[model samples]
Target: MAENKTLKVPGATLYYQVRGSGPVLLMIPGGPTDAAIFAGVVPHLTDRYTVVAYDPRGNSRSVLDGPAEDVHADVHGDDAHRLLAELGDEPAYVFGSSGGAVIGLNLAARYPGQVRTLVAHEPPCGRILPDAEEYLAGTEEVYQAYRTGGVEAGMKRFEEFVGLSGEEQEQPQTPPSPEMMEGWGRIGGNLDFFLGHVLRPVSGHLPDVAALRQGPARIVVGVGDASTDRQYAYRSAVALAEALGRPPAVFPGDHGGFVARAEEFAVTLDKVLNAT
Candidate 1:
């Protein structure tokens, strides 16, 4: 059974779900993609671990107390720390995808002892790449499109920017729920928060290499096997891993691999988690 709960942080009321048993494993979703995004992969991990997923502040059920402002990577990282502390789980295992991966990197660097192991999948750390200015400009362009036209137009540009145009985009294996549909309906607001607050901060975030290198937690950078080399996310993962003096661990499918290939992704995650 899954238990839905909320925690009051400094400026937001975070909504989180807990399920299964054993060691605690916290899963963090990408930009504005609330806890529901991990529904497919959570079930597989639940059998062996207590899976905890949450909606970040200003996204979905996790509402911010004040006006939505531009947020930094450390702010989100602090939220993750508060959530873990509220869950009464010290040094928990963490799996973070896309934007969430950047948060995990921040957490590992800033609050090292709070995380046992952090698996960061395809973090779009554009600043770490060679053509960083180009990538950053593209991200800004997507945000501008969102501001001018709307989510559809923005997403279209985003897809093309990430090399997901045409046949590259994968079909959903499972249908979305009513709750998810409602969330999608309100995605415009989330998109605004993402574009205004998250995009630049996360993409430009330079993880504290020295801090992370000296931190206690084990850090593992992940990249999707099917993710094209053209995508900055794939390249960023490789760059991040190299910075950490570790190789990027390859997983199944592309950016949304956890949902697109849940079974295989889970198995690979289990191995990575359990490996010495």
Candidate 2:
């Protein structure tokens, strides 16, 4: 009922899993994490669609060369494109969370033809906000800490930024082993590159906030039910919905909504995605 495959992309080998049959839905994960984060959620949807989740070119099972110099959104976008191509030429519906959502937006903008529907959930594309300068500065601090002090420092800063609990923060705070660090470094490099090159420029070019207003392609903003009102993810979802002239549908749980309440989230997701 499940198959694992290795996909070779430009900078690394992507480890991915596929389940079920039907239209393909690409799930892009967040954090310094990978596909496994979606384990709980994938089962609920596999019966309705082909679910493809992969470790991005430098995370988890994926391998990469010495932290390729800065990596931009286009670089990450290219990986998504290559993975989708390998799966098949058919367009895919995409659901991306946090950093993944940011990547999804770039993919949609750059390769509009490849995306059938995009559920950009809680993207913290902070540059799109009115106070972008401060956000970028804070992000820079976190990246720098990660580079110098390691994962704990980086995660601490991230948790502070997102207002996560100390224990919840600890979940992803462990440093990557030396071997995994190489991949983390590559991913980190891309994160740095994205900050400078992609963030602001891409925000400036966003389609008329009115495009989603027409609804040929469903572009929905989803926020976690348990997320705090002030959390960046929730705020971003709110802002995106406002920009698109729509409202964000509440997902089943907190920021890791799909995983925390997989069954309910899948039901809601299916309803929303299939509505189009």
Candidate 3:
């Protein structure tokens, strides 16, 4: 059974879900996605681990105390720390995808003792890549599209920039419930937050190489085997691994592979986590 709960952090009210029973495995989502994105994979790991997923501040069920503003990676990391502390679990295993992976990097760098191992999948740390300027400009272009046209416009540009098409582009997404409509105000409100506050900060933010190198937690950067080399995330993951002095662990599919191949992804994740 899954239990939904909320926690009051310094600047936001975070909503989270907990399921199963065993060692804690916290999953952090990326893009504009919330905790619910991990629903498909939860069942596979429930028997062996207590899976925790939550809405990052200002996204979905998690709301900030004040008006939404540009957020830094460390602030998101701090929120992750608070959530982990609230769970009463220290040294928990963490899996962060996309922007969430950026947050995990900050968490491991700043609060190493709180995480046992951090598997950061395709973090869009654009600054670390060789073509950093170009990628960062692309993110700005995406934001500009959002400002002028709307979420769909921005998403279209984003999809083009990321090279998403065919099955990856056509994959079905779960629609929001009627109840969720109330809190969010409008359908594209979260997209506004992602473009105005999240995209640039996360994608452009540089990870603290020194802090990570000296940190206690084991860090493994991940890239999807099927992710094209042209994709920013795949390149970013490769760059991040180089920065960390380690190789990027290849997973089953592209950026959203965990969603497309949940069962296989879970098995791969289990193997990654258990490896010595």
- Say which candidate scores most in lDDT: 1
lDDT of 3: 0.84
**How many angstroms is residue 178 displaced in model 3 relative to the true structure, after the best TM-score fit?**
12
Sorted by TM-score, highest first, which candidate order results?
1, 3, 2
Clashes of each: 0, 0, 0
Model 3 C-alpha RMSD vs. true structure (Å) is 3.1
lDDT per residue as tens, model 3, 1-276: 679999998888999999999888989988788876777777889999899998888898899999989888988999999889988756999999999999999998988999988999999888888778888889899999989998889888888776563434324234433433443453356888988889888887899988988888989999987787777888888988998899988898778777667778899998898888
The candidate 2 region of ten consecutive residues with least summed lDDT is 167-176
Q: What is the TM-score of each candidate against the true structure?
A: 0.93, 0.81, 0.91
Candidate 1 local lDDT, 94-206, one digit each (tens): 99999999999999899998998999999989888888889889988988887898777887888788667763655456775565566566566687788777777787788
For every candidate in turn, the CA RMSD to the true structure comes to: 1.9, 5.4, 3.1
Model 2 lDDT tens row, 133-224: 77667667766766787666766776777556443421222333343345445555444434333333333323334444554456777888
Q: Of models 1 and 3, which has the larger TM-score?
A: 1
The runs of at least 3 residues in candidate 1 whose Cα sits more than 4 Å from the true structure, single-residue gaps closed, are 172-189
Candidate 2 segments whose C-alpha is farther than 4 A from its true place = 66-68, 165-216
Query: Which scores higher on TM-score, 1 or 2?
Result: 1
Q: What is the lDDT of residue 112 in candidate 3?
A: 93
